[model samples]
Target: MRWWLTAAVFWTLLIMAVCWLPMPMFPIGTGGEHPKRFPHLDKAVHAGIFVVFGLLWLRVIPGPRRFLVVVAAGAALAAITECGQNLPIIGRDGELADGLFDVLGVFLAYPLATFLFRRVRDKQPVVSMTRA
Candidate 1:
């Protein structure tokens, strides 16, 4: 796999880890000090993270199968990570809204990735001494 692909996978895993961090140790107890419920911020963070990973995956996939592969990968990863929250170690809440946000993140990432890849590919190659 290309370096970018590796980076993308690494980033996806990293984000999953971060998302699961504040769950078990910081469980929202029944009190006045509940965790801040900023749904919009949560959505934005999810969308932004996946958008970057999606673009990078799209870059690495190459050829016509790029978009489909990237999107499917994003969705699969999202599902796996969400389900993994049920594990004893992580103990994160598995909410449908979170999964929905994950899907949206992948969906929003695809087009931007495609456009960036296309733009870069369209650029003219620079002649160098090694090519002569």
Candidate 2:
């Protein structure tokens, strides 16, 4: 539990840093200098990052309401990141599609994480303590 919480905090900060960083810091080919080999690659990256982000939060947050809270928080963070990108000083453009991809990533992560958790749980051996 402690490890999961620490991971969640670390990952969240990493995401925030990536979103707030300057455009030039990104890979050279990611921009208009050359035709993008994979035009939608950025969206895919956003989705992938949010998927991990949501899963990390889910691991730390307990209760039946965990899914709802995590998804909402992920979406809010996505929106805020997109808005931040629009700041003139940042010189980054905000796109609705990016936010949509972020939300989709979080939503998709729930089922994937649930499946993995169940698989691992089922494979674990039961242990019993006894006095000989």
Candidate 3:
């Protein structure tokens, strides 16, 4: 449990760092144009990160309350990161679409982690001792 929480915290901080880091100036024709080559690639990456975030939290969270807490936290974090990007120091713009994708990722990952966890647990062999 501790390990799970630790990992979640670590990942959250890492994501924050990546989100807040100032962008480096790219050579002409190499920066903004690249994103056009891969439509919605940024949103996909944002979703993928939150998906992992949701799965990590699922490891520590349990019961019916899991969804509420995990989703809320994930959404709050997403909002914060997006808002942070708006700061001039960060040199990034905040996008509502990105935040939406982040929440979407959390929603998608929660069920997946729950299903996988149950499946793995169900398949585990049970050991028993009996008197001979």
Sort all candidates by TM-score, best to worst.
2, 3, 1
| Cα RMSD, each candidate | 4.4, 2.2, 2.7
Lowest-sum lDDT 10-residue window in model 2: 27-36
Clashing pairs in 3: none
Please tell me which predicted candidate would have the highest TM-score against the true structure.
Answer: 2
Q: Please report, in order, the local distance difference test score of every candidate based on alpha carbons.
A: 0.71, 0.88, 0.87
- Residue range 1-132, candidate 1, lDDT tens digits: 578878987887797776666463654432214247753565566677877877777767778877787778888877777787777777666656667787788788777766776787789686687844
lDDT computed for candidate 3: 0.87
Q: Order the candidates by lDDT, highest first — what do you get?
A: 2, 3, 1
Q: lDDT score, residue 66, model 3?
A: 88
Tell me the deviation in Å of residue 32 in model 3.
7.3
**Poorest 10 consecutive residues by lDDT, candidate 1:** 26-35
**Regions of candidate 3 where Cα sits further than 4 Å from its true position:** 25-33
TM-score-superior candidate, 1 or 2: 2
Q: Candidate 2 on 24-60: residue-level lDDT in tens?
A: 7765524434235667777888999999998999989
> How many residue pairs clash in all the candidates, one count each?
0, 0, 0
Two-way lDDT contest, 1 vs 2, winner: 2
